[model samples]
Target: MYISGIGIVFTRGRGIDSFEKALKEGWREPSRTGLIPAYRVGPETLTDASLSKKIRRADRFSRMAVLSAVDAYGNSGITVNEREKLGIILATAFGPHTTTFSFLDDILDYGDANVSPTKFSNSVHNAAASYVSAILESRGPTVTLTQFKLAFQNALILAGSWIAEGRCDHVLCGCADELGMVMECACKMKLNIAKDGKINPFAFSDSPVSVPGEGSVFVMLSKEKGSNNYGKVGEISFSQNITRKPDLFVIDTDGMSAYETGYKDIINYDTVIAGYSPVFGSMLTGSAFNFAAAALMLKNQIAYKCIFQDNPFGAKLCVETSAKNLNEIYCIKICRPEIKTIVRLQK
Candidate 1:
């Protein structure tokens, strides 16, 4: 399947308008906070008429997914037919973060017997996917994936395979993550924070910790391409037994090794959109952030720079370039200590 269109709802740093403005301004002070970036969307972004009221009723992660899906579908300009074969593959590293914590609190305060059904229902990993299906009035297949940092990549792979298999005409694939007190506490315990409580991934300073942030991104995938806004979905690959240290993997390698092993042998692409930074923050749903960012770059015809840091295992590398040719292909490389993989998306 090909990636037809993409939509992103990130922390308030840069939307299409702000991104253009920053481009003209030379990207001097780009937003770097890992928190959920701000985004722009229409009032009709959500299909649920009660979404506005439900905003307070739902978890933050669910809200992000709902808002992002609306923006994505709007940008695609493809209306969903209830009877058409459609599917959804949603992913998240931390599912129902706020609700998870709230549920914990409830269990702590009132014990398991008094936990609210509302919270329990909303806390499921697939809640956001269910909401999206309901809002779109889609009765097609819906699946949720959770693979720690590989959640988004896994979802994309599934969506692509489903389309390739003729199981669905369209697949709405997305990844969403949110911050919560539990995450903050974990960061404090795990990372070596600076005086200001910021952790720079590039900096090997005493703090090897990454900052925390969250957002939701969506893409529409289809097998046949027409006059719609579309981006080429080149290829996806995965490798097990990476034989690389996790920290060194991100900083030392330009991600070239994974590309060479997985995608380079099959196809050659000109540009690569890196989704490393956003994923770097939590290392949980980092792939989602990178995938979404890369998709946006392909959709907007923009080049991007991917920065990696140095580690004891290897030398760090950052890639900075743009699409050089119209047929310029883009590849996404994902790796764990045990597995290394690559996915290719064409222009």
Candidate 2:
């Protein structure tokens, strides 16, 4: 399968150009106004006056997904001969939990019968996908898969299966998540919250720190190459030869997910390493963000410098942002010391 187009709504900004600008620039500190510092999306970024009536009732979670998915469809610039042939698949770890919290608020403040129907509707995990499909008028199979582990990579795997099974000609696969007050309190109590809001990928310590972050990313996938193609998503594997290195190894080593020390074994190879979790913040869906960066690199044939150059572990890091011949990139996410998900993209 090939990645024809990409749309992203993240902490820095929205759209593919914004993502590329973030990569060229280095890492920035996460927001600190809340109880737990996070990479929360600003209100201005989600403002779409043109589609206000279309998504008037969408909450922040839905807005992120809707806007990102919409951009993914438009970014592809492919006139769908049949809207029914285009499918939608949204992958998320925590889908609209903030809206769920608000719905609970409605039940607590008002009676059960007095709950807001609009809020209840938006609370469902599939609401975002529905909004995307409705706005795009895509009548194909729409799915919402939720998992705390490998959500985006697993979505890619499923997208491949759907294409092979002749379910649809194309699939709009995406991820949406948010950092609400309830979730912030939970992360504060449950995880090691980074005080300065900076995640060090090179800190391969058993005890890793995390600064919670949230946003959405969507990619248009199809078997045939489009005019504006990122690259071909060749292999989606759970287990692969770690010894076989690509031109670049894009590691999703955000401190929140796995044992950081586990990455020590994988980095011993000779391929140049890159990780962009610090820019987006730590989330189970963070691999999608890394995949976006890899896709941009593959499309442009350029290697972005590692966000933070302070490497104590002496891993082969890309220190300079320069033009390079990038033929293949392996975006790997380690759920545990043993479990690994690799997405291979080739030029």
Candidate 3:
């Protein structure tokens, strides 16, 4: 059984109370018609040591990753044995862009003489993963991935494959992206930043731009289905360089033909979890937010809508099941200009 024990920390809310509040209020920033409500962390919420330790070394992305990882482990309710085989897979669209720009700024201003090695090291895409492994004392495999919008999905597929291949029995999968000065500059330069500085996802538009926000989310995956577990991953698949017909298009398609092809193959699923909003804020790890919501949906046996505006690549949906059947089946259809592929998921 492939299921995720989820943890999430976002601007929309923190912990369960905040999360539920945001959902209940249906908070949406009108200016950024394609983004979710932003969440912010206050100094009072963090200990001095935690705040001070990260001040000089960690970027917004890294901090989010660490906090989300901690939350995920706590929510899983399963203590990881020191000897258990574990793996980590993280995904981000703009990995450590904030820190990367800081290093560049130092070089541009000081010609490298004052460039801090520690800052440089922490700026790497895998820095968050490294810190996570060390903090958890996990010695198993750890890797990071980037695929623009598909990074989290790729991570899930990779994590699942590792389990299927007997590489690990337990794995932690995560996604994180952060807002920074550089990101703000880019948005302004591109003229994509909303005047009101928010993101809206359901608005109808041919060109959709998102506000920038920061957050991270993680999930624990296991091969064995414990009685207390939320749900199991039924199947995961991916396709690159695909081509198919255009009628299947929904809106501003961003390399989503493969996902649509996957959707057509799904037949039994009634609910879908989507991550399109996270990316609207210029955060690449949109799927991480979707993963958090998906876990909740599965556990509650609820179906929810993930709205996308003028989606040309079809909307991403996750179906939840209430029946006590072991062999639930789903079909997904992906289409490109010249190619069509179908995959099936069964559990």
- Candidate 3 local lDDT, 1-347, one digit each (tens): 45546666676544534543443344355323223323344333332355355444666677667767766766667777853478888888888887888889889988868897977998899999987787777777899887664576678778888888988888889888775666555655654544554443433323445555667778888888754475666545455222322111112122212233333322222233233343323454554564454455445444333333333434344222232222322222233433332222233
> Candidate 2 lDDT, tens digit per residue, 1-347?
88888999999889999999989998888888899889999999899998999999999999999999989888988878788889999999989998999999999999898999999999999999999989999999999999988899889988999888988889999898898898899889888888887788877777778888889999999878999999999888886666577899898777776577877776678789988888899888898899999999999999999887667788899999999999999998877866887899899
What TM-score does prediction 2 earn? 0.98
The number of the candidate with the highest lDDT is: 2
Task: Give the whole-model CA lDDT for all candidates, comma-separated.
Answer: 0.55, 0.88, 0.55
User: What are the models' TM-scores?
Assistant: 0.73, 0.98, 0.72
Per-residue lDDT tens digits for candidate 1, residues 140-238, read 789988766457768887887887787888888888776666675665465443333232333333324444556677778776773454466655556
Worst 10 residues of 2 by lDDT: 257-266
Candidate 3: deviation at residue 223, Å?
Answer: 0.9
Worst 10 contiguous positions by lDDT, candidate 3? 245-254
By TM-score, who's the top model here?
Answer: 2
Report the poorest 10 consecutive residues by lDDT, candidate 1: 247-256
